[model samples]
Target: MRIGETAAAAGMTTKTLRFYEDRGLLPATDRAPNGYRDYPHETVSRLEFIRRGRTAGLTLAQIGEILAVRDIGHAPCIHVKDLLAKQLHDLDARIAELTALRATVAEFHEAAAAGDPAACDPERICSYL
Candidate 1:
């Protein structure tokens, strides 16, 4: 199949397919005489795998490592688990920070609703209610 057809089948853009190829995630199997990329039917599965990996918060380099393991006929479950663990830790930290920020914003909103003109402190740049 051509790049366009393969990309559509994988629910990705042709540009994304080309980017994956450049990133060494999905190298083309062959090229036509006109220089168009020729991909095998399985390319869709590969692209889907890449898409899922990215959605799971894996970077291209991380996905490339998984692909390398697959290419070498090894299971990538361990590596993927480790990566997910790290991402979860990072996400937890971000969630805590966002929760604190939300509390601060809610407090400010309450003060503004109370008609406290001092709420709009010029030093704070947003102190006025």
Candidate 2:
């Protein structure tokens, strides 16, 4: 398949495919006499794996590491597991931080609702903000 066909199969734009290639996340493709990219049938599956990794919040470098390991005939199972655990831990921490922020905002909302707007300070930004 050509770049267009491969991109369509991967559910992404041609530019995205090019970006992945430029980023070295994708391997170089074969070229036709007309100077067009040619992809194998397995490229679509590889694209799907890339898409899944991105959706799972893995960085390009991390995905590249995983792919590099696989390219070397290694399963990368343990490495992937450790990376996932770290990602999950970071996500949990961010969620907790956001939850606390939400609680603070709720308190501010309540206080603002009960306070007198006429008493607002003229030399400073809104305290609620």
TM-score of 1: 0.58
Q: lDDT tens string, model 1, 6-48?
A: 9899998999998888889986579999999999998889888
Q: lDDT at 101 for candidate 2?
A: 95
User: Model 2 off-target regions past 4 Å?
Assistant: 74-129
lDDT of 1: 0.81
Clashing pairs in 1: 119-127, 119-128, 120-127, 120-128, 121-127
Q: By TM-score, how accurate is candidate 2?
A: 0.60
TM-score of each predicted structure versus truth: 0.58, 0.60
lDDT of 2 by residue, 17-129 (tens): 99999998889989999999999999899899999988867788878866776676755587766865776687688679889999999999998799887787788896677
lDDT of 2 at 14: 92
Query: Considering summed lDDT, which 10 consecutive residues are worst modelled in model 1?
Result: 120-129
How many residue pairs collide in each prediction?
Answer: 5, 0
Cα error of candidate 1 at position 118, Å: 32
Pairs with backbone N, CA or C atoms under 3 Å apart (clashes), candidate 2? none
